[model samples]
Target chain A: DAGITQSPRHKVTETGTPVTLRCHQTENHRYMYWYRQDPGHGLRLIHYSYGVKDTDKGEVSDGYSVSRSKTEDFLLTLESATSSQTSVYFCAIRPQRPSRGTGELFFGEGSRLTVL
Target chain B: AQTVTQSQPEMSVQEAETVTLSCTYDTSESDYYLFWYKQPPSRQMILVIRQEAYKQQNATENRFSVNFQKAAKSFSLKISDSQLGDAAMYFCAYWSQGGSEKLVFGKGTKLTVNP
Candidate 1:
């Protein structure tokens, strides 16, 4: 298992409230990603960071934003919590120089969020 | 755009039996990578196996193996002598060799190992 930790393992918030999920990694990996898993939708990428201050949009980055000011911490924030955002969010890390051609992702336990 | 498709929503296999999970992906890029991730009830994504598009040989790890057919755009996972520990949601994923390392995952197939 990777030394990755996600804060607020479980959360319940109102629909209009803003929520922020934090992911911390001790491995100091250069690549970090955020994904949401819902029934029938599997895991959809919300956003990812290649390096500190370098971020990019993912397939489902509409209402979500991510920041990586420090190498060890990556944060995902929901502008306005919605029921559709209720899902298990996972944080993953990969080495900057991948040993194998296939980049394998080491994930955190996951954060379960519910929007009422 | 790249897309991964896992045709089976759910699958069951008896203990000590073999089971195959199918996956197909679409990509215009010539060089890429394919992977199988296992998400147990705990919801931790674990890497099971991986196959490089440029390699013709399949990838095997312990009880897991993948049949990679680049020409057909098919990547399937075969578990030999399935055990109860193998019961989980298996996802097929794709990643480009260049550009970005972020993966695109398919709707996972739930696998049940019958006791």
Candidate 2:
């Protein structure tokens, strides 16, 4: 186990509501990523943080945003929930020490979101 | 842009048999990494195997191995002695070595192991 925990294991919210999902890791990994998994679609990266206050957009970062204020915590927020945002979100972390291709990713249990 | 493709949407194999899942990727970068990740019913992603483009030899983790055909741009995963536990969604991913750590993933293949 990577000691990764995602808050609000499941959530159901109405459209236009703001929702934030928290990902906490005890491993102190330097790289943290937020991704969404939809049916028939593979996991798509939304955003990732290399360090505290350092973040970058991913392939599917249009409606979602992420912030990492500390090494162990990464947060993903949906400014206004949409029906299209209803999917499972996952948090992943990779150690900083090993070279680029050295470390494997450790993922959280996942958070299921439903927007009506 | 890098793209990963898993042509098979679903596959089934008898327990104790061997099965190979196909995955192909398109990327112009020469230096990169290929990986196979397994997502079980728990929805927890687990790394099955990884292959570095620079390495000529294939990567094998226990019964899981990858056939890396860099020239053909194909990376396929083969599972030997399949077990019921192997039933899950398998995703093939690609990551460039150009400092961008984000991975491009395939749609995934749902594998079912029957006894």
Candidate 3:
């Protein structure tokens, strides 16, 4: 329990629709990541933010975008949802302090999305 | 780039028995970290154990222990006295030392603890 929360624990949207999932953290960690879990692919990174307004694409960033306006919130938006985008999305945070070089990630419960 | 592999897709162990999950990773970096995570039906990703590649000594946490062979590039997790609560999907992950905060994870191994 790293004080991380994700909104819309479960969602179902039609294809070509817009969907956004929110992740909020109270720990004030400097690094946040968005990952999607599929059956065979495991968990693939979608996007991550190292600091406020500083975000980068991940392995599976197509059709997905992310924003980190402040230290506590990171939002993942699907420009136009597709059936292939249906999966469980997880939000993770890590302490960016140089002292913590281990790079351990504390993850939120998860948000399950269904694009039909 | 780093890649982790978990050969076993699923495994089972009788209650109180021991079970081991295998993991192998590919990385050119000499220094890095390895981890094991558990995701139950609840879908919460929980850290089960971790090992630093530089540490010769294996890492252990209560009933969970990791056999980390830096030379073999293998990190395996052994669970003792497996409990029903341990039934879940287990993942092997890797993170480079002193690099980006990104973590690469394996496909995962689903473990079942039978009563």
Candidate 4:
């Protein structure tokens, strides 16, 4: 538990509405990632940030966006929610240059979002 | 792009028994890393074991161990002396050596431990 926290542990929003999930870390890790967990998809990367103000798209980035203004916070937003966007969103962080190729990833509890 | 695959969707084991979960991946890069993550009902993802592709020796952590087959692109997790706490969804993940350090995970295999 690297002091990672995800806000709105559970949420329900109507379709076409915008939604944002926040991830906060206290470890000051340089890398942060956002992933959505679906029933059959496991965990699919939605977006990731390497440093402050640096962000990149992931495998399932089509309907999502992320921003990291500070090293401790990363936010994932859905411009317009969709039914398919309903899933458990997770935030992960890894210390800069993980040693020994272990590439350890610390994950938040998770945020469950539903779209109606 | 790297991909991880877990062939078994569900598995069961009895207490004090040994159980192995299979995982395979597709990667062109020779030097990379593999990991097994466990997510219990608590919904928190915990790292169980990790293996480096370059290392021929398998990695073990307590009751958990990994059988890393670099040539076959196979990484499997074996849990010995299984306990009820071992019942969880196990995920296989892959990460490249360089760049963003993003992880690609498999669908996961649910492990049920029967007392």
Worst 10 residues of 3 chain B by lDDT: B93-102
- Give the Cα error of residue B16 in candidate 1, in Å: 1.0
Off by over 4 Å in 1: none
DockQ each: 0.83, 0.72, 0.83, 0.82
Query: What DockQ would you assign to candidate 3?
Result: 0.83
Estimate the TM-score of every prediction: 0.97, 0.95, 0.97, 0.96
Cand. 1 TM to true fold: 0.97
TM-score of 2: 0.95
Give the per-residue lDDT digits (tens) of candidate 2, residues B1-115.
8899999999999999999999999988999988999999988898898898999999999999989999999999999999999999999999888767888899999999999
Error of 3 at A84 (Å): 0.4
Native contacts present in each candidate (fraction): 0.82, 0.68, 0.76, 0.79
- Candidate achieving higher lDDT, 2 or 3: 3
lDDT: worst 10-residue window of model 2 chain A: A95-104
The prediction achieving the highest DockQ against the true structure is 3
Interface RMS deviation of candidate 4: 0.9
**What ranges in model 2 sit over 4 Å off?**
A99-103
Kindly provide the TM-score obtained by chain B of candidate 4 when compared with the true chain B: 0.97
Model 2: per-residue Cα lDDT over A49-89, one tens digit each: 98999999988898898889999999999999999999999
User: 2 or 3: which has the higher DockQ?
Assistant: 3
lDDT of 4 by residue, B49-75 (tens): 888888899999999999898879999
